[model samples]
Target: MKRIICILSMLLCMAAETVMAARAPVSEATEECLGCHSSIHPGIVEEWQNSRHARITPREALGVTGLARKVSARTVPDYLLPTAVGCAECHTLNAKVHADTFEHNGVSIHLAVSPRDCATCHTEEAVRYSGNLMAHARKNLAANPLYQDLQQQILGRPVRREGKLTFEPPAAETRQSGCFYCHGTRLEVVGMETRDTVLGEMEFPRLSGWPNQGVGRVNTDGSLGSCAACHTRHAFSIEMARKPHTCRECHVGPDVPAYKVYASSKHGNIYAAMNRQWDFSAVPWTVGKDFTAPTCATCHISLVVNTDGQVLARRTHEMSGRLAWRIFGLIYAHPHPMNPDTTRIRNKSGQPLPTDFDGTYAAEYLIDAGEQVRRTETMQAICLGCHSASWVRGHWKRFERTIRETRSDIRAATGIMADIWARGFAKGPDSDDSPFNEAIERTWCDAWLFYANTVRFSAAMAGGGDYSVFADGRYQLSRRIQELNDWLELRNQLFPPTPPIALRGLPEKPYRVQ
Candidate 1:
C-alpha cells in the first residue's frame, strides 16, 4: 500500500510537469520590439520606453494611463500613469518572460505577453481588459467591411464586366507601407535580407517576430491573431481601448471618420457626458454594471442585459455572436479566406480545427448589427441611450448608403483607371511606396475607405443638426474618386500608342461572388 501510494504521487508529479511544459509561459517579445521601434517612431515609443511596460512587462503600466485612472481599484503598488500609449506595449518582438525564450520565424524568441501578462503593471487595466471588445477585437472584427474593402481594393481591380460585378484579387502587396500599416501587420519570419525600405524602412529583426495593427492577423504558424492592437498591451485597460481616442488612430483622417463623426453626434455627446460615469475597470461588462457605457466594443463585442433584468459583467472573444448579415464589400471578409464556410482555428496539437469558436470569438462577431439587441436595434443601439433610435438609425442609414455608394464609385474609378492602363496610356506599375503612389493610396482611402466613411458617420452621429452643420455629405469621398478619374484622363492623354482594346471593365477583373 505504501509503495502504491508513492507510485501514484510520482505519476501525479509527472502529469503536472507535462501540463506545465505544454503551455507557453509569458515570453519577452515586447521588450525586444521596443529596443528597435523606439529608435523609429520615437515620439510614440518614448513614453512607453519609460513606461513600466518598457522596463518590465505591459501589465506594469495598465492602470497608470488613460481612462484606467478611473478604475478606482489601485493597490499599494500604484504610480503616476500616462494617458497615452504606443506600439511597443502590444506589438513587441521578444524578451525574457515566462521563464523561457520562444522563437520567431527561425529565430529563438519569446511569447507575446498578453492581457494576463499585463496584469503586473496595471492591475485595473487587466481587470477591465478582460471584459472589453478590444480585448478580443481581432476575433470579432475580422469581417468588418471597413477593414475588408481596403485590403481587397489594394489587391484587385474593382470591375463590373458583362453586367457582372466581380472582385478580382491582384497579387497581394504582401508587406508593410501598404494598406496593412493601419489595418494590421502580420509577423512572419525575417529572412536573411540586408535592407529594403519597402519593409517599413527597417528589416524584420533576425531575432523577434512582427505583429501589425490588423484587426485580426493570420499568423505564419497558420493560427489566428493577437488581441493587443486596440486593447494595447500589458495593461490592456478597457478605458484606453474604449475611448474614442483609441479608435481615432485608424478611424480618423480623410477616409475613416469614425472619431470625427462620433464626436459630432449625440452619441459622442453622451460619451463625453458619461466619460466619468463609464466605469473603465468593470469585468464581464454588462451595460448596467459599468455605468451604461458603450464604446465600439459595446456594439460589436459586449453582451448587455435589459434594463429590467439584472445586468452582469460578461465579455467574450467571439465578437460575431450578435451579428447577422455581412457587409464585407469586396472580399468575403477581411483578407479573403479561401473558404467562407470555414474558419481557421488550430488546436493545441497544432492541427487545423473545425469552424469552432472555442478559442475563437468569430461566432459572436458582428455580421450585422442586431443579435445583441437588448438595448436597441441597429447600429444605433450604442447611441440610443442618448439619442432616439429612429433619429439615430435614420441618420446612420443615410450614412450607410454613403458608404455603399462611395464604394461603388471607388469600383467605378478603378474601372476608369483600368481603362487608361489597358489602352496603353500609362507606364509600368509604380512602386507601392512611391510618394505618387502614396498620394493615390490616400485618394483611394478618401473614395471608399476613409473620408467617405467619416463624412457619413460624422453626419449621422451628429444627428444632422448643430454638430453636423459643417459636415459634408458623400462629397468628401466623391471628389477624391473623381480626382482620380481626372488624373487618369491626363495620365492617359500624355501616353503614346495603344494596343487593341479589350475593356476588362476593372483592371485585374472581378471574380465570381456567392
Candidate 2:
C-alpha cells in the first residue's frame, strides 16, 4: 500500500510539471506565428522547442551571473521579460530598418535576421564581431580589384582561341557558388512576389541573395553579418556552434584545409576517441573536466576555465582577437591587420594589399609588434590550460620557425615568377594583364596560397606529420619550385617569347612545291 501511494504521488508531480511547461508564457505575436508555422515548418518548431530560447525568458537569463552568464545585456525591456524568445521576437523586433520587412497576417515580418537582431540579448558578442575581419569579408574580396581579378581567373571558364586561351567572365550564379558562398553576398530586396501558401496566396519580399548564410552577409537591414552563420537559425544552439563540424562547412576546402589539419592532429585524435563522453554545453567550458580535447571553438572563441573555476581565456566573437599572425599568406604571412576593414590598406606599390609582391608589409595597416605580443600571450594562456609552460614555449618557438621557413620558400618562388615576368614569358600586373590568368602564374599561386598555408596551419595546430612533410606542404613546395624553374629553363631553350601577330609575317601557302 505504501509503495502504491508513493507511485501515485510521483505520477501527480510529473503531470503537474507537464501542465506547467505547457502553460509557459508565450507572447501573442509568437503564438500567432506558431499557429501557422508549427504545421508549415514543423522542423523549425521542433528545433526551437529544444532550444534554451524556448525554455527561458530574458528576465531569467539575465539573472544568471559570473562566468555562467551567457546574456551580455545588463537589462532587457519589461515587455520582453515575460515571454520566451520565439520567431516573432527576432523577426519582428527591428522591422522599421529592414527593407525586406513585409506584412504577413497583419504583422510586420522580416525575412533575414541580421546580427543586429541578435544584439538585443547578446550585445557584447555583436559588438565584438562587428570589428572582426569576418564582418568585412565580402567587402575585402569584392572591393579589391586585384583580388577580384584573382577570383575571376579561378572561376572564369577558359577557351582556346587562335592557339591562345581567353577566359570568359563567370556568370553571377557561378560567382555566388564559388567565392561569395563563403565570403558572403550583398543581399537586397529586389521586389515582392506573391506565393501560394497553406494560409493563402501571400506577398513576400524577394531577396536577391536568398539562401546565403555567409558570415559577412549584408542584410536588408544594413547590418554587416549573419548570426546564423554559426548559431544556426530557429535553434541557436551553443553545442552545435562549439563543435568542430560547424567550422568544417567553410574551412574544409583546399584553400583553407583547417578542418583536415585538425582532424589529423593529436588533439583531434583525442577528440575522436573521447568526445562522446564530453559535455559540450557547459557555459564556461572547463578544459580538463568538460572536454579532454580541444575543438575549434576551444582555442579560438570559447570562454575556457580551469578546474578551480579560474578563467583561462575570455570568450571573444572577434575570431582573430587571439591571433598574432595572419597565416593565410597574402603573398607571405604577415601580422594580423590592425583594422577589420582591409580595403583602406595600400602597399608600397599602391595596390590594396597588406603586403607588396616583394613581401614588404604595408606596416601602417598591420598590427604593431606590441599588439602582436599581447595577442600571442593571449593565445599562450589558452594553451596553458592543458599544457605546461615549457611545452607551450617550445610549440610557439617551432611555429615561429615554421613561419620564417615558409616565408623563405615563398620568397624563392616569388623570385622565379619575377624573373619569368621580367623575361616577358608571362603577363603580370605591370602589363595590365592578370597575374593569375596563365598556368605558370596559377602554379606560383599554389606555392603560397595552398602549400605554404597548409604547412603554416599544420605548424600552428601542432598537426605536423603528413601535412608538413607530404600532403601539399614541404614536399609540394619543393616540387613546385623545381617545376617553376624547369618551366623557365624549358621556355628559354625551346620557346622564346611569342612576337606580336603583326611582327610575324603571314604564313606561306602550304601547297607550294611539287
Candidate 3:
C-alpha cells in the first residue's frame, strides 16, 4: 500500500511538471497563461490542444489549400507567421479597445473577446453579421415596448387580486436564464470585487449577464454579437457549425418551430438516416457527395460545390441572404428587411416595427423589389438541386397563397377584437390596457404568433401535412377566430351596451318620433 501511494505521488508530480511546461511562454514579452490555465481550466486547454489553431502554425496554414488559406491570410502583423494561434496571439491584438483589459500577473489581458476583436481576422463575416438582425437582438428585445408587453405577459406570473388580474414582472434570474438565454443579455461591469487567492488578495471586475453565447449578447467591449454562439469555442469546428442541432438551440420552440418542422420532414429523415457517411470537414462542400440531404446550414449558410468541384453557391454569415420573404408571420407575412437596424426602419404606414417580433423576422418592413427577386432566385437555386423548376415554383406559389389566406383570417380576428374594444366590452387596444391580461387578447396573439407561424413554416419547408392540417396550423387558426367571435358575442351579451349621452338627452323626443 505504501509503495502504491509513493508511485501515485510521483505520477502527480510529473503531471504537474508537464502542465507547467505547456504553460511556459514562447517569448519574454508574452504571459505564461497556459501554465496557470492548464491547471485551472484543464478542459479548455485540452480542447485548445485538439483544435486546428494549435496544430496549424501560421506558416503551415499559409501553404494550405482551400478555406484555410482565406482564414490564415487575414492574420494581421506578419510577426505571428511562425507561431501557433495561442491565447496571446488573439488577446494581445486590439488590447486598447477591450473594456475588461487589466494587468494580471505582469501581463495585460482581457476577460472576454468581443466581435470587434474577431473582426481583426474575420473582416467580411463581421461586416455582414453587423447588418444581421441577430446583432441587434438584445437592444430590440430590451427596448421595444410591444415586446416588453409580451415578455411581461409570457414570463410574468399571473394572479387575481381584488377582482382584478395582475401580472408581476419576471425575476432577473428568470429573464437571464430564459428569454435572454437566446435573445441575449446586456453584460455590465458591476464594479470590482476582491478575492483571496493562493498568492494574495486580488481584485477583479464583477460582471453580470456573462458566460453567455446568445447571438446578440452585448459584450463589455461594446460589440453587438457573439461569434461563439454558432462557431462555439476552442475547437470552433466547421463540422459542428454545419450541423442542424447548433441552430436547434434557440429555433426549436413553439414560437419559431423551425427545428421541429425540419426534424419531422422528409429531408430531415434523409439526414437522420445518411448524414453519418457525409464528409462534413470538406472545404468546398459538394452537395451530392458531401450530403444527400440538407441540414439547416446546407440550405442557409454553407457554400455548395458540384461533384466536379464547380462552385454552385457561396457561403454566407447572414442566414437571411437567400431568403426573400419573412414568413415567420408576426402581424402578417412580408418581405425580408434590408438591414438589421429595425428601429430606424419604418413601415409603409410609418410605424417602427418591433425588432425580432418573435425570433428575427418582422412583417412591417421589407426589402426592395430587385433585392427580393435576387434573394428569391438564390433560394430557388437550392431547391433546384433536388427538385424540378415546376415543383419549386408551385411550392412558392402555394406558400404565398397561404400567407394571403392567413392574413385574411388574422384580419377577421383583429376586426372582431376591435369591435369588442369599440363597444367597451374590455379595455381599448390602444389604451393603457395590457394586451395579454384578458383571454380575448391571448386568443388574438395565438391566431397570429402561434398558428400563423406554424402554417407558414410548414408551407415554406414543404412539410405541410402535419403542421398545416392538425398540429397548431389551419385548425388552430380557425378555432381561435371562432373563439374570438364567440367571446365578443358573450361579452356583449353579459355587459349590455349603454345608451349614448346624445341619445339619452333626446330619449323622450326619439320615442315620440319612432
Candidate 4:
C-alpha cells in the first residue's frame, strides 16, 4: 500500500510540471520576432516602443488600482505576466482558433487581428462599440431598399435608349472612392494563393474589400467594425482619434459638413493655434489645462475633467449618449432614434418609418423622454465648462428654433413637389417610375439634402454668419424655392390647361360672354 501511494504522488508531480511548462510565457519568441522586424520595419518598431503597451508589463499593470486595474487582464497566466506586450503576445495567443493563420519560418501568424482578439484585453470597449451605430453602418445603409433606390437614382445616370429610360450604374472606381470608402464594403475570402518571397513560396489569404479601414468593415473573422478606423495601425495613437481630421475622413461633405463647419468656428481656430502645446495623451482630459477649446472627441467621447483634476464625466464609446436631436433633418427635423436597427422600427401610422421617413424619430424605438432629457442635460453640462448657463440655454434655444425653421422650409418644398406629382407634371411618388429622374425632383432633393442640412449644421455648431446666410444656407433655401416655382410655371405653360367640360342638359344652354 505504501509503494502504491508513493507511485501516485510521483505521477501527480510530473503532470503539474508539464502544465507549467506549457503555460510558460512566449517572451523569448516575441524577442526573436522583434529582432528581425526591428530592422525591416524600424518605424513601426519605434512607434510600438514609445507606446504604453511596451513600457508596462502585465504584472506591473495588474498591480495598479482604479482605471488601470479595470483595463488590465483579469487573470493572466503566470508565464505571460512578466512580459511587455509584443508581437507573439497577440498573434500567437490562440493560433488554432483563427481561420486565416499561416505558418511562417516555424512561427504561426495571423494577417488580421480581429475585434475578438482585441476584446481579450479591451472587453468593455469592444462590447460597447459592438452596439454603436458605426458597427452597423454597412447594414443600415446598404441593406435598406429605399436607400439603394436613392443611391441608384442619384449616383447613376439615366438615359433614354431605344425609346425607354435605362439606368447606367456608376463606375466601380467612383463608388470605391466615394461612398463605400466610408460606409464600408462587405469582405470575402477569394481563397488562398501562393506567392514567392525572399523567405520562399508561401500561401496567403486572397481577400476582397481589403486594405480598407472603414468603421463598419466586415472582417474575415465575422467581426463588425475596424478599431483601426480611428486608432490607426500599429501606433494606434489616441491623439489621432481625438482630432477632427480623423472624422473628416467620412463627415466632410455637402450633406454632413460637420468637419467643415467646425473648422471655420472659433473653437477650431483655437485648436489650430494652440493644439501643439496641449497634452492629448493625458487621462481625464482637463478642460482649461489640456485644451482651451473643444475638439470633436472632447465634446463627444473623452472623459472630461475640471481644472482641479476632478472628473466631470466618464468616457464613453457609445457616442450618442449626449446627442438629443439628429440635426441631419432627412425629411424633417426629428429626435435621435433608439438604435441603428432601422429594420425593426415603426412609426405612429403603422407604416415602416425607416423606409418612408428620412429622419422620423419613433418614440417607442428610442429611449424614453426622461432619458433623452438627461442626455441633453449631460451635453449642456459639457458646454457649461466654457460658457455661462444662460448663454448655453440661449444658444440651444436658437438651435431648436433653427431646426423648426428649416423643417418649415422643407415642408413648403415638399408641397410643391407633391403638387407637381399629383398634376402628372412628374411621376407620382408611388409610381414605378423613378421619382428622382425629373428636374423638379432633383431640385427638391437638393432643398432637403444639401441646403437645409447646411443651415442646420451651421446653426448647431455656431458656424459664423457667413455660413448661415450665404454659403448654402438661407440664401440657397430661398433660391431653391424660387427655382421650383419657376419650373412649375414653365411646365404648366408647356402642358397647357384643359378646357372645362361642357355642362349637360339645361346648364349648357346659358353661356355668358366674358
TM-score for each of the candidates: 0.48, 0.93, 0.86, 0.84
TM-score of candidate 2 to 2 decimals? 0.93
User: How would you order the candidates by TM-score, starting with the best?
Assistant: 2, 3, 4, 1
Writing each residue's lDDT as its tens digit, candidate 2 over 1-514 gives: 9999999999999997885595447899999999999999999998888788998899889989899999998878788998999988989978999999999999999988899988999999999999999999999988888788888778889888889886778887888887888788988988989999977899998888778888888889888988888888878999999999999989984678899899989999899999999999999999999998889998899999999999989999999999999999988999999999998988877778787777888999999999999999998998998899999999999999999999989888988887787677887765666778889998999999899999999999988589777987889988889999899889877866566222111111111101
**Model 3 local distance difference test score:** 0.73
The numbered model that scores best in lDDT is 2
Model 1 lDDT at residue 332: 15
lDDT of each: 0.45, 0.87, 0.73, 0.72
lDDT of 4 at 457: 86
lDDT of 3 by residue, 1-514 (tens): 9999999999999998886455423433333777777777889877877666666656665567774254623455677666667777777667786777777786777777777877765677787778788888887778766567678878888888999877788987788888888878888878878999765888777778876788888887788888888888877778888898989999985778888888878888888889899998787788888888888888888888777776666777787898877777656666777667655654333335522222223344568778888998888787777788999899989988887787777777777776766675665334446556687788988988888888888888776597677787889989999999998788767876665322111001100100
**By lDDT: ranked, best first:** 2, 3, 4, 1
Residue 202 displacement in candidate 3 (angstroms) = 3.4
Residue range 129-228, candidate 4, lDDT tens digits: 7877787777766765545556777676678988977567766555545566787766666789999965568788776776667777776678777887
lDDT of 1 by residue, 236-264 (tens): 45567667787677666544455666776
Clashing pairs in 3: 23-35
**Candidate 3 off by > 4 Å:** 1-31, 62-75, 197-201, 347-351, 354-365, 496-514
Error of 3 at 74 (Å): 4.5
- RMSD to true structure for each model, in Å: 16.8, 6.8, 7.5, 12.8
Q: Model 2, which residues run further than 4 Å from truth?
A: 1-24, 495-514
lDDT of 2 at 379: 89
